[model samples]
Target chain A: MSVTMDKPPVADGAPRPYTLRQPRLPRWTPPALALGAAAVAVGIGIGAGLGSRIQWGLIAGLLFVVGMYALAARVEGRRQAKDRLATSLVWVCFLLAVVPLISLVWETVARGSKVLDGGFLSHSMSGVLTIQPGGGVYHAIIGTLEQVGIATAISAPIGLLTAIYLVEYGRGRLAKAVTFFVDVMTGIPSIVAGLFILSFWIIMLDFGYSGFAGSMALSILMMPVVVRSTEEMLKLVPNELREASLALGVPKWRTILKVVLPTAIGGIATGVMLAVARIAGETAPIVLLVFGSQVINNNPFDGAQSSLPYYIYEQWAAGNEASYDRAWAAALVLIAFVMILNLVARGIARWKAPKTGR
Target chain B: MDITPATSAAPPPLSGAPAPAEQAKSATRPGDRIFLGFSRGSGILLLVIMAAIAAFLAVRAVNALSHNEGNFFTTFEWSANSTPPVFGIAVLAFGTVVSSLIAMLIAVPVAIGVALFVSHYAPRKLATPLSYVIDLLAAVPSIVYGLWGALFLVPHLGGLYSWLNDYLGWTGIFAYHDGAARSLFTIGILLAIMILPIVTSVSREVFLQTPRMNEEAALALGATRWEVIRMSVLPFGRSGVISASMLGLGRALGETMAVATVLSPSFLINTSLLDPGGGTFAQNIASSFKESGEIGKDALIASGLVLFVLTLLVNGAARMIIARRKEYTA
Candidate 1:
């Protein structure tokens, strides 16, 4: 490198016999060409009467990839063309995802805001018929809060204990069986959980549709999530903490309780919150188990109740303009609630993340 | 009494609290005993719940199946509430498989591409937010997706469906009589969008885990960036992508409201995916449950049983695939 530099700069007219030549496409060419391709694709889509933005995007994406490769092959070489194609395709994929997601959120906010004033949040559909316009998610919110609360109350402890067994005291067949089943349990569909509870609590035992019954199925869905997240958290806690507690002559259970749980509490809380968030938006279980009510029912055990997701489904199923408006409002509320929970959980997780500096 | 403190970092207490090695060593605290029993009970209870779900669903499904007048696998009509209760899963099973398969086909490629984009192509500053937005997409409820599909996407798809039918109508599958966009194809697209985030996230994680050393090795061998990815990254992530796709497939099969909202339900199976009316298992259960009588409810439960088994199999296979690759990857 030093010898080449010391020799001197070559003039433009020099033959440059020792120089290696590897021609490359200009950096801006791909993006410019991609933009052109996208324009062409959209024009074609419109001319051909393809309505969906998805078709337009797909066509644009294909054009961009192919165009990038062709331009690169002409300017540089085949290998370089392949490289450009991959990169452009990847960009197209990212854009394809971004478009729908942005549209979903945007569409929800725009449409939902029309009926999503304070009245919508504060009132219930007590006397409001399916076709009536004035209704809120108040009762549904109450039911969601209660049902999710009950589910969390039931699942968190059991899931925490199960994780503890798997991480700390687990051995042999029982532990293996528990771990395996937990994976299987993680895959159980929310509706199947509803059906399970339907058969077990409602069918065989003759329990009426109630928020408590919904809680039962929601707990089933929440448990494995809690377990997996808690297990990961517990695994993160260093062995030194447990060993230190034991060295101090602390009892095993006390060590776990005082040392392990506190240390991992942040992640555990995050996990539990995520679990709560998961169940809060669940419609299938509540639709079946709670048997959504139009009026408010404070008591979870005795009677049918309204929940946010169920209300949305019920309203949508009604198939009227007013009902559609209500469904959109409910969906908006549910999305906000779940998103808030997720953000908070993630915030707590990041904030309370264990320090590794020591 | 033997204390094995040297073997493990801490001495194992057979019970929760051991007294000592020399005197009354076998003695344990009752608190330790109770706590251990409680925790062990929780673990055992999970197993019990799984077992109970399977057993109960099996019993109920069998009871409903035995009472059916029509052939379970052949009949298209669902009339479990009527006298002589004629019903079958023929249409439901076909729709579920077809919609999910279409979902997988559409979702897997897009998801893999998105995963590759995030892990490989995107700038460092851009990648985090893109992935976070995608994660938020995953968090959005199925009901919301269903609403969007029904309200927003279906109408927009009319032109696309007509185009497909017009251009590719020679293929019996694309042939369409009506221009209504409420077909299995629409449901499949919605499901594809719905399942995209999970697949992308999983495969992104897997792709990111590809060893930098192997990537550098390819790069050092005069391979271009794409060649490096093809040689090292894609090979390493193949199992992960498969597992991710399977997980997405599991989601598509079991998804309820989205399919329920999008697809127009009918008893008959049509060859044209562009035509509406075939129903999926979860969708059928969800749509039928509210109006159905006791016998009809039982029938829905039976189909729910089938959906349950199907998801379990798909997820189990995914887990198995991931576990098998763990040896190589780790």
Candidate 2:
């Protein structure tokens, strides 16, 4: 073992000079480069009279990436340099996305908080002029509630049944076609649905504008969402449960009704509510179909009606400071309503997830 | 319910079913028959609705198109309510496509990065809440975004537009004339923000689903984290990312209130994106609905048909990609 090879590569070496560890930049290198890049960007911005902080930030981001690549390449290797480039880009992307979203929420809350009050909530824009401040979303809220309620009532059962058919009984070409069309249905723009109802309900049948027409369109939008979500939940039900019920001489329909549905009921309710939340904020279809009214219209089947979203739109279109305040306030209420529904839907999913055992 | 049972019973006697079929059918009770019929009918009803939407829209669109004094595809002016009812979709098509193109250009790469950040880069503690925030962002309704865009984003974008014009005005697209910052470009940015969450969520799911073994093998070869992702994750999720972007594009094309709120509608197509004038199909429809006559309403319906078909193609292609990817993975 100790026999000396005269031409050994490591001649006269105590231990090969090579080390397993590569020469790595210090951990502080990234932050240091970022700070230097920021300084340079600020300098360039001031010198060039840049108007937007966005431009400065973009320059700083670019400089940081370039600097990081150059530094890492020199100290470590090209691979590490590329990795640093990717890391920086990903971080920048996250920051870019976060900015607009935060601004949206913050602006809505800040501007909207100015006019939102009990009086604003309880009164209607019935007698008030478009440019004045004295009005509320009371009628709009009622219209939205009734229209959305009817939409849910119409769509939920049909959507649920469609899902049940797809998951439980779907087999051949008809099922496949239904599935494909349902996917396509989910992509129908709200306005197209409105146009469909408009042509059919008003143009063909000669009915005037009513909230019922809007509800029909909203139901069209809600149906596909409900079907998709409900189908997923239904597919999660255990086959063995159905088998066990069938073995006990329970009819197949009864097995589905009494055994399978109860198991998935929590998820089904959540899906329907989420669908409701989705349609509740739709404004485009309502503008065409409902023919928004300033005063209360309790009967959705009657003349023109306004919903919360339509109210915000109508107010904003009025183009006055007072109208803008009302729009913002209504927007705040709408957002709050939507956010609560989302939270509750997710909460229900979390709470019921354990019982499903998947 | 009783009517359904009666109809089912009526069908059985005429078919003259075979023995095993009859036995099997009898084993299933009337309740099963009715339930099956009802659920199946519901599925058929959905198909019928889709067909009706297409058919009815076509009928109205054709009626409007026939009466038009101007070329439906080429003419720029829209005076559908006027005598002879001249209207066309040239400007609306340009605005819709250009705005959505800008939206796709900005949104797709950023969405992928956000997806990667959530799936790989972020700390575990940060990732959960970050995605939650994104989900909330998606749930924030479009009208709220419109309000924010008009009041907050439109005002704030003046500086950025000027900066862009200063550097890139020679390109003509970025040229700004110091007008209100409610151009198609502004709507593009707003649409990008709106579609970001959906794109991110879809891409994140695909990225997360990349096989653990492939990633681990790359890492075992002394690959850095980013290298591992580039080698193992991105290739697998490429189609997913494409489909996600297409889905986002579908959304951007049909988006109504946000664009309607932000863009100052005019019938002319602007060479510079920084200009305040131009219209989208959906936006034109919404803005003109109030002032139009019956012919105008039909003309708006005609425009909606174009949006509907365009979105359908985009979404259909996206779904095909997803379906193909599913087969490959399975």
Candidate 3:
């Protein structure tokens, strides 16, 4: 009855109006038009003798954007059309950014699986030449694991203690200075980290190229990451827990050790794992310091060692089909390793989150 | 005696055990003192490492600069392995800045677009998963990006190269040389892609943090959705976007593997971006270090020092902007 009262005015002799007119564009219009524009783009690409898929994509994107804007302007008014245009542009930008990244991953997996297997995973490239087909990243994997493990070992205690200091005991100028420098260290290029180690350890101290040297640089890179994340986690732990623990007859150190660290352990672990993943894939420092070797050197302190990223770079630079395959396989392994670390870290974060009543 | 009448008024057992403990107590506990020492030592060690990085870099850089046969700042040639060791950072510095600028220019707008897509345009279900996927993309190693750029991107860009040169060739900057597709333009595109997730994620975070009350107020005034956003969200997030772009620039300036793999270097700077030759600092270091002698290594260290300072300044400025914004928001 209320809707009928607000109906358009009409004389008794005039024909009754049907349904009300809609002001918005149909919900399915954008996607349907996008598909049509893609067809048009492909057609024009073929007609105009453009051979690149990138060109085809670009043409399609432009067509879709223009087409959507024009159609929206016609059906809807100017204001709504402008809004639709902005929305369409945003969607298009997201798609344009996403497609290439997805393509990169697909290419890696599709090409990498051919050379990845148990045999590939277990063998070393020591006896194999660059032109041969029978070597794997086993040695590089060993080098990466040992180097990353050593870096984590060196960084975790220092990073953890530093976070504790900042969160619990920090007071004045020194804490602020530490915080500022940590920010700076976070932005240090990996190669610069390598250069630092190269200057102090290898050049001045007369040490040789070895996996240990790479670990030193990796630790420098890894420390700031660990400290930042751990500090964030420590900050998330509430003060009441500390107050309660101290209200007991417990010493302040014991309260931090027993209460604060326990409550934030899950997040701290996740942070450390993420830091490990980051340093694990670093190539610049390893290239500069570890100086990739074909042979598997188990002892990190003795001689040059191959790492996964360094291996990928070395194989790619070799400039041959066989070496390219090895590089792709190593890439696949590295991706898998990093992804696994990330997944486990996320899982731990979820599983161990402090319980609040639902 | 027993502190006179006060001890007698308290319980006998309570007062008996506490007297010795009170007499022996110091201002601070032993455990607390030891732990404080340990943590403070760790903090000092961090500062020492940072100071040492700067100190060592300076010493070596000075050593290399002193022995140079050519002007270290302006010479175009890099022949540190030669007898007199003639080398400089002129081309390297130019390539680093130009490529990174191009990267920031391209990546910033697209990233803002993508961020708006995730935060404002996409449905809730899609937005959550899309952000997760973007975060995953951020974790993909730079080496992987380099490999993909070398194998796939370089080949695919040839058509775009010809297209650009055909249309914009008169500008000289866009002119084609018909050589390897490896050029600074390609490096910029690769860097843009590498930094996209970082910028998008950051801007998305800021966009998501826009206050709901202001949004509702705009909507109550019969404003359209875009109008509400233009009135409130973008204004709120402008500094955040700037800081994010600076962060991306920092990454692009220091990026190593992708630039090295994608660009074929030459000593001379060509105005044509479609031509294949320019070198970034990180790339130059990575490529030249393998065969360098002692002095050559030191010269490369000097360049690394430059890259270090550049990134530090950019990051410091970004942090300053962010910190100031925090006070403004409060």
Q: The CA-based lDDT of model 3 is what?
A: 0.90
- Listed models, DockQ each: 0.64, 0.65, 0.66
lDDT of 2 by residue, A1-358 (tens): 1232222324434455655455678989878888999999999989988867777888998998888888877766667778888998898899889988887888889989999999999989989998887899999999999999999999999999999999999999989888888888888889999999999999999999999999999999999999999999888888889999988988888998998898888788889888888999999999999989989889999899999999999898999999999999999999999999988998898778525554
Taken over the whole model, the C-alpha lDDT of each candidate is 0.87, 0.90, 0.90
Interface RMSD of 1: 1.3
Highest lDDT against the true fold, candidate: 2
Residue A143: error of model 1 in Å? Answer: 1.1
A1-358 per-residue lDDT for model 3 (tens digits): 2343233332222464454542457789998999998999899989998868999998999988899889977765566677778888888899889989988999899888989999999988988999999799889999999999999999999999999999998989999889888877888899999999999999999999999999999999999999999999899888888889878877888999999999999999999999999999899999899998998899999999999999999999998999999889899999999999988997898887754333
Off by over 4 Å in 1: A1-21, B1-27
For all candidates in order, state the fraction of native interface contacts they contain.
Answer: 0.66, 0.77, 0.71
Off by over 4 Å in 3: A1-22, A356-358, B1-27
lDDT of 2: 0.90
Q: Please state the error at residue A128 of candidate 2 in Å.
A: 2.0
The TM-score of predicted model 1 comes to 0.93
The C-alpha TM-scores of every prediction are 0.93, 0.93, 0.93
Q: Which is better, 1 or 2, measured by DockQ?
A: 2
- Model 2, B1-330: lDDT tens per residue? 576887777666756767568668655679989999999999999999999998999999999998999999999999999999999899999999999999999999999999999999999999999998898788888988898899888887888898888899999989998978999999999999999999999999999999999999999888888989999999999999999999999999999999999999898889999879999999998999999898899999999999999999999999999989989889
Considering only chain A, what is the TM-score of each predicted structure? 0.93, 0.91, 0.93
What's model 1's overall lDDT?
Answer: 0.87
Which candidate number has the best DockQ? 3
Q: What lDDT tens digits, residue by residue, belong to model 1 across residues A1-358?
A: 2343223324322644454544567778877887898899889988986767878877888888888888877766666777888888778777777787888888888888889999999999999988988888899999999999999999999999999989987899999889878987887888899999988899889989999999999999999999999999999998888899988988788988999999989999999998898888888888788998988899999899989988888888899999999889889999999999999999999999876558
